[model samples]
Target: MLALRRSLIALVAIVGVVAGAVTAWVVTEASDGGAHATRGEAAIGGPFELVNTEGETVTDQDFRGRYMLLFFGFTSCPDVCPSALMDMSRALDRLADAAPAKLERVVPVFVTVDPARDDVVTMAAYVENFHPRLVGLTGTPAQLRAAADAFRVYHEKVMPETYFGGDAPERHEKGDYMMAHSAYMLLIGPSGGYVANFKHEAGPAEIAAGLREHVDAS
Candidate 1:
């Protein structure tokens, strides 16, 4: 009886050690920047209601299971917006072409700041020029302000173009207005929290490299 009792105790001890080791491994992986931390810290992911390019309602919960790259810009912007989209599309293409499976796990999101100018039809037409997988969103001015607030972005319309042209104001396009804003892209994980936010002003290769760096690390 004594021998049997000792054997049972020893078996229990072994199991305890094994379980402890497994737990440590899991914790390390979850915290490792070199690993794609599932359910990462709560910063980026949250409930949001946005209008899709199709004029349909899209909520934050719709993107619960994929990595999302979100950018805030307007279609009417003279330069930054289009250039950023093009760069992002190229990066995604490179990532996809390299690893087809990654395509299923990644989603690119574009949120327009000038909702007044980016109606469903307008946003749709702009998105169509980019990759087919790209998604565009815009809503009411209230919705826009709310979303921008959530992301902590600054954007406003500017007027009085060329007012200082030697007292003879240059002719404006009448309907042409410029958006004063900054360009940056936010990257989020499956947990819907921000993992990385890279500046959209970066060159395509740099942006792509940053993405690859993170993906590879993860």
Candidate 2:
């Protein structure tokens, strides 16, 4: 019985490691070049209804005639979220300088994973700090989940203790928690299909180039 239990534990550990490795490989490949090349066959992205910064309900259909550059994150994120948004903003700026007309056809959107704290007013204020053309979106938990699911985004709330460990500061309130989420930005075509993904590490110029290629082709 003891031997069997040990064997099961070992098998579980191995499976966990393999799953993590596979996930990392998929994300890396998607970010590198596979996403663009496999866009036609990729099943990512679909219909979603969410609220805009103006408190008006909006759907994916509203963006049917234009390309959508979508990102998922929260406003209060201390580092990753803000950095990713800044990179996206810079990429758009680069695109504007290269192809002004194409820039007009692409809409950069920020969707908050923490809808409870990211109301329309909060979204509006947060998005304004990024690209002028960037639109902020937040909705009820169910609505946001639908949108996140459509894009295969991963997000989970983590308490400071779990996220920061024993070194966690005392300044965090009892309800204060952080979100762990996927950092990739997704590109959707004018007809509401997945195009490609940009890794968080992808720089402004690379993203701009990708945008120019896809927008020009579309």
Candidate 3:
């Protein structure tokens, strides 16, 4: 019940610095505060067919006109998933008063890598705890795999018995037993291409700063 309040800057800062390592390259790729390049190998790619909490046929196209903050995780994750989402929610809320329409322009998403267990119903219930606007999506195994591969997310099923070296249920089942996954926060522009990326562990303020920069430009 405490997680929903969450949270980015301007155009050139958002679109142009496709490079996480090179400052000049970012300048070249983007104008004063806008991205100039059309397309490149980015965090946004691949096609997916998943259903949103509303049970609608949610696909990548649904976000055509807006910025998308996408993350790969599940409702059952014990550590990274909840912590990150909570931080994100809190960060977004702090920015709300400053940029009333920013949240509307940039949507946050939570997609379960474990679709077999994270169906529409479960995903829906879980996301609502974090933020009213956070969307949860899931689908058949096939859909899940496609999305994961596209995003370079890695998840492995470790049976409960073998999950931990033998830890408590609250420690293992809620965590170690769950699928091991790669966490990445992605930003997709209106054209459905990767423009920036915030790896898992990026602070909420950093994430909010990134989003603010990118969303304002678009």
TM-score of each: 0.71, 0.80, 0.74
User: Any idea what lDDT model 1 has?
Assistant: 0.68
Residue-wise lDDT of candidate 3 within 149-212, one digit each (tens)? 7655666676545433344355444444566565557777777777677755578788888777
Per-residue lDDT of model 1, residues 49-135, tens digit only:
889988899977888778787788888765567877899898888877666566667789999989878999999999998878999
- Report lDDT per candidate: 0.68, 0.80, 0.69
Candidate 2 lDDT over 154-191, as tens digits, reads 77898867555444578878889977677778789998
Ranking of all candidate structures by their TM-score, best first: 2, 3, 1
Which pairs clash in the backbone of model 2?
A: none
Best-to-worst lDDT order: 2, 3, 1
RMSD of each: 19.1, 10.1, 8.5
User: lDDT value for candidate 3?
Assistant: 0.69
Name the top lDDT candidate: 2
Return the lDDT, model 3, position 105: 81
Which candidate model has the greater lDDT, 1 or 3?
A: 3
Off by over 4 Å in 2: 1-40
lDDT of 2 at 41: 32
